[model samples]
Target: MSLLTALEDGVAVLTLNRPEVHNAFDDALIAALTRAYESAIADPAVRAILLAANGASFCSGGDLNWMRRMAGYSHDENLADAEKLGRLMQIIDTAPKPTLARVHGSAFAGAIGLIACSDIAVAVPEAEFAVTEVRIGLIPAVISPYLVRAMGVRQARRYFLTAERFSAEAARTLGLIHEVVPAADLDTAIARHLKALKAASPAALKATKALVAAVDQPLSEAVIADTARRIADQRASADGREGLSAFLEKRKPNWGQA
Candidate 1:
């Protein structure tokens, strides 16, 4: 299997299994990831989602053979392939549960999109990043929106055009990742985030994610009203009441304690 999935302690971990290829993804791997995300989103037991890879490098982007095959494909065929990749990115970006990426070694080309789509990302200090599609006569089209959202248009412009590699610290400066820890502490950092997520109400987390998305648009009277309604809805929820009561009572809510 190109992807390994496990549900443990309310976290659904999706591991890229092709270490030999630096976890580079092809059509099949893309399909596998899309299915994994869909399943995790629908599974009630899954409170969080983690994307990790078993490899020297987190991901080196598209598999070389996959690109070679695309060279022989007609325009329509290429479009279909690109669409599948796009869908995978969309699924991760829009997941209701909190999503995290554990990045290491290198995240290049499309791999950067996976990180961008994730709600949070943590990388080792030695990890590298690049948007090198332009170097190979291609544009980072499908992943452009997520990349731009993660690093803003100004930084994306420079990297997309220059195809220059940047350090993990640089990626954090651009807001592509939240933390740059030592390789030995990578799992520790992931555990801390998972612990924090476990302490929150699952439904509230989902609602909060939706709230963020809703407010991303231009603020209007409608948008403001929508925000008001969202908070009101959550306030009326069972978890909301429990959370408040627990806070007043100086005890943990029904959810796990951090």
Candidate 2:
């Protein structure tokens, strides 16, 4: 299996199993990831997702063999291939459940997109990152939207063009990663985040993720009115009513009890 999945305590841990290639993605791996994500989203028991890998490197981007095969393909064939990868990124980015990237070692080229698409990313201090496609005569086109949103266009422009390896500290400053900890503490850090996620109402968490994506778009009158309606709807929801009543009664919310 290119990917390993386990569900425990409301968290679905998706582990990249191809240590031989530093967990680099190929067509098979991409397909496996898409299925894993869909399965997790469809599982009611899963409250959060932890994306991890089994080797020293988090992910080194595209598999070398996959690239070699792409080199001889016609333009249309290549476009089709790229679309599959883009679809995988889109599914994870817009997933209703909270997603976290547990990054270590190096995350390069397309791998950076996975981290950027996640709601939160935690990396070891010694981890390295790069947008290295430019160095190899290709562009990070598919991952551009998520990268730009995570790192801002100014920073994305420099890294995407330069293809230089950056430290985790720099990545944190650029908003690519949320926290940088020692390697030994990576699992603990992820656990902390998962605990917090599990405590929140699942419906509210999904709504919040949607809200962020919506707010990022141009704020027109329609957008404003839509947001107002969403909040009003939430306030009148069963979970919302229970949350308010629980607070007033000095008791844990029903969702938290689970």
Candidate 3:
């Protein structure tokens, strides 16, 4: 299988295992990833997710044959297929649990969407990236939401228009990679983040993530009031009180207690 899912110690790791093709996505890979993400969401035991790939490259984006297949499909079929990819990206984007993209190498086209949807990304400095769609005569409409969100309209305009290759450093500068580490130390860097995540409360992490999604970058008064309401609710909740008490008393809150 090109995709594999495993859960251990409250962390779910989904590996894109198609090294022969740099984990380029096909319909099957898309379906497998969707199922794996859904399973992680359904399983309360899963507190975090790590997206990594086997091979010298993280992902090559759309498979050529798959693109050919889509090129020949009807418009309606293409729309439906696009929806699947969009849904998978959205699921990962809103997964409640934290998501980390472990990119050791290049990520292009649709493949980059996965990274953009993640909460944190740790990539090797040498890892390359590109929009890689205009070169093939297709617009990156499907991946636009995540890609634009990650790189913003200004950066997106340059890359999406040029479809030019850029280094991982450029990606990091554009707010894509959270940290760009040496290739040999990529996994170690990601592990450090995972370790810190593991020490935090899963429920608190989930709620915090939800809050971020719900109220990031908005300066509207309504949003401010709504955020305050949420904070007040958390302050009075069992988890909230326990977390506060633990901090003040210098003790760890029992996992189930909050």
Candidate 4:
């Protein structure tokens, strides 16, 4: 269980278990995470996915050896390797279920991508974050989409250029972390968020997320019409109808029930 995954009461916990290496991403780590995410997305019992890492720190970003291997490759080969990491980020970003990143310690470089991809993130107050790519003469390009979107252009400008390490409190101020808790109570804190997520309808949650992201995309008649149709279809679905009914009936929605 190097990449531990468990679906309990509608929450899929995806724990990065390679504490021995600071949970850095080598080929094995990427493959394990991709598999766990795919499983979480496919499991109907899972309403949300939580990403976490064990050990004193969270992910240390790319493994140094992994970088050294990439450093020897041609530009095309390097891009290919980067794409693999990008794909993992995309899978987490567009996961049909909601995602949360629970960071207990430092999250650096590509590790920030993980937090950025999560729909919600809660980090321990002592956790640190940095975009350390520039410190090693590399650009933080691959993670630009999630990073820029998470921190916005202004904040990305500061971090990407300076490569400065910042605290979790600073990340929250920049709108990255939804909340912060002491390490002593991180589990309790994450559980509180998951409890709220559990109360939501899975399909409705997915539909709502889609709506939120798409509703403001460059407005065109086709975009508006397509989105309207998409929402209308979901509103009439089995889960959708049940969700509305459950609210009126004052009962939990049928999630995790066969």
Which 10 residues in a row give candidate 2 its minimum summed lDDT?
A: 218-227
Ranking by TM-score: 1, 2, 3, 4
Give the lDDT of residue 160 in candidate 1: 90
lDDT of 2 by residue, 40-158 (tens): 99999999988999988999998867765655555455656766777788888889999999999889988999998889999999999999864444567777777887888899999
Of 1 and 3, the candidate ahead on lDDT is: 1
Show where candidate 4 strays beyond 4 Å: 216-258
Q: What is candidate 1's CA lDDT for residue 102? A: 97
Number of backbone-clashing residue pairs for each candidate, in the order shown = 0, 0, 0, 0
lDDT of 3 at 86: 69
Candidate 1 structure quality by residue, lDDT tens digits, 1-258: 899999988999999999999999999999999999999999999999999999799999988677656655554566567767877877888899999999999899889999999998999999999997655445677777778877889999999999999999999999999999999999999999999999999889999988998887522334333433443343334554455455445676674222
Give me the overall lDDT of model 3: 0.79
Best model per lDDT: 1
> Candidate 3's residue-wise lDDT over 1-258, tens digit each?
899889877889999999998899998999999999999988988888999999889998977567656544554566567667767877888888899999977799888889988999988878999997544445566567667777889999999899899988899998888899998888788888988998999889989988987776523334333433443344344554454455445676643331
Return the candidate ranking by lDDT, descending: 1, 2, 3, 4
Q: Write the per-residue lDDT of candidate 4 for residues 1-258, one digit (tens) a residue.
A: 568887777888888888988888887788888888998899888888989888978898877666556544554555456666767877887787899999977799889988988899989889999997644445666576678777889999999899999999999998878898888888898889888878888778898878866863523334323433433343344554454455445677674232
Clashing pairs in 4: none
Q: How well does candidate 2 score on lDDT at residue 26?
A: 90
